[model samples]
Target: MNLKKTLAVTATAIGLGMSIITPAHASTGEENQESPDACMKSQSASVFKYAIYFNSNYGGAYRNVGYPVYDFADERVGGSPQAGTQPLLFCHGGSGNNQGIKNNAASVRNKHSTYYAVTYYNSGYKGSSDWATPNSSRNLSQAYNQNASFNWSSL
Candidate 1:
């Protein structure tokens, strides 16, 4: 082909290719990125009626609990006696997403219709604690980020 015709074809092809190539864009779509932990099996069996927040005022990543936790640390997870090696963590997409829930929570919501969720500053459900009434939410006053255990009671 002639130089002009060849140049014209090349230009058109380049233009078309360039047009087809869009600028890469960061994904704005949100998805649950939390990986399944070993204790998830037991978690599914629990009620998960309590929400523990990473920030006061019920903000940031949270973990929902159904049963009592003697220690936020390992050796026990929630109400299960399985002695899980994996630590409990907050849900994804929040301020403390994928972070450990022990001693890191600052707020809580009691979703249980008939039970009170208690957060303790010391492990084994002892020491200063903050309680959230059934179906209530509260910013941890004593426990705050020093929380170490959790339990639900009728009182």
Candidate 2:
């Protein structure tokens, strides 16, 4: 083939290959590149519905968001009690401090659409624990009342 014709054929082939490949990947609905947290946020508008109310039965100070709240010292929503008096506190893998909501949470609420949160009595997810289901709110029982750390899992 002439130089112009050969170049045109090559370009057309490349274009067609890209078009076919692109659609194949797009149609699979598996091109997700978001992090797990981001994915959870997108899957449920209620993901951000999570909050820890200070008072019982979803009352008092509250923290509402998809991300785990490790500390309540900075949160003063609705004149929330001091860290130690706050109704709730969340902790991840690391061991949380003894003071503050570590052992003073009065209530817990999980508004996630597909995940359940596990609260522990001691920091670092050690000691006793209680699992809070999604879209649910309840007062911390006497045993798990003073929770320290917590983590969540998909349902």
Candidate 3:
């Protein structure tokens, strides 16, 4: 073939090859949403009621392998409990719930081997003791200071 014709054919072949090539992308479009279930058994039965009790009575529960929980950050104090060390958790009662908390305190304390007490205030609205007041600065300040005084953040 003549030089021009050979060059033209080579150029056409190169253009076709370049058109077929694809630029690399970071990820594929498809992804698996769930993995195969492991041979894990459910222990949710005990975890649910106990966790609820802890939250209602003790602010929160200690972490366990099979349970999930949450609590107000302002209510808990963390400290190392040595062999003979006595730890305490105070539950401030809301409204006329003093009797309820008082009755449960011993059982909770026994379960944890730690002192549990209930704080009762003047008769007021339901839910939280501090909710009756319009301004929460006093409440927040008290909560922050109390938690800070005991260094609850460390726990």
Name the candidate that leads on TM-score.
1
TM, every model = 0.64, 0.46, 0.14
lDDT of 2: 0.45
Query: Per-residue CA lDDT of candidate 2, range 1-155, in tens?
Result: 35675565457536634211111111111111112331232323433444444456644443333433333333333333445433233322122222345555566777656667666666544566667887777677742446655556553
**Candidate 1 lDDT over residue span 43-125, tens digit each:** 33435567788888877777666555656664342223553344567774569887887879988877778767889999866
The number of the candidate with the highest lDDT is 1
* Candidate 3, pairs of clashing residues: 77-152, 78-155
C-alpha RMSD values across all candidates: 22.6, 17.9, 26.7
**In candidate 2, which residue ranges exceed 4 Å CA deviation?**
1-49, 69-99, 142-144
RMSD of 2: 17.9
